[model samples]
Target: MRMVTKKQVPPLLLALGASVLALVFLLAFQGWIAHGADIFLSLAQAGLSWCF
Candidate 1:
């Protein structure tokens, strides 16, 4: 098996950032989102917070 490398981190960070940003903007501007968007963002924010 191959080992994981630091190069993989940037993309995951970008994806997480985008998800968090979109969630924030949606909440502030649109006021609400569909089921999947809401759940996904909640999970992402929890993970990001946990990491930090």
Candidate 2:
């Protein structure tokens, strides 16, 4: 019987993960995500204010 002690992550997988993160940041910086986040935050704040 043989046992595997260690597992390795592929470089391609790491590169893909980094690229996806970078794309998300790029979009956020361009206001694609920031706009949506602003709307969400304002709605949440309004809702909280109305509750009190």
lDDT of 1 by residue, 5-52 (tens): 665557789999999999999786665444556766787877853442
Give each model's whole-structure lDDT: 0.72, 0.78
Per-candidate TM equals: 0.39, 0.51
Q: Which segments of model 2 are wrong by more than 4 Å?
A: 1-4, 32-52
- Give the CA lDDT, 0 to 100, for residue 30 in model 2: 83
**Candidate 2 lDDT, 1-52, residue by residue in tens:** 9997887789999999999999998987788555766766777877853442
RMSD of each: 13.5, 4.8
lDDT of 2: 0.78
- The top-ranked prediction according to TM-score is 2
User: How many steric clashes between backbone atoms does each model show?
Assistant: 0, 0
The prediction achieving the highest lDDT against the true structure is 2
Residue 11 CA displacement from its true place in model 1, Å: 0.1
**lDDT, candidate 2, residue 48?**
56
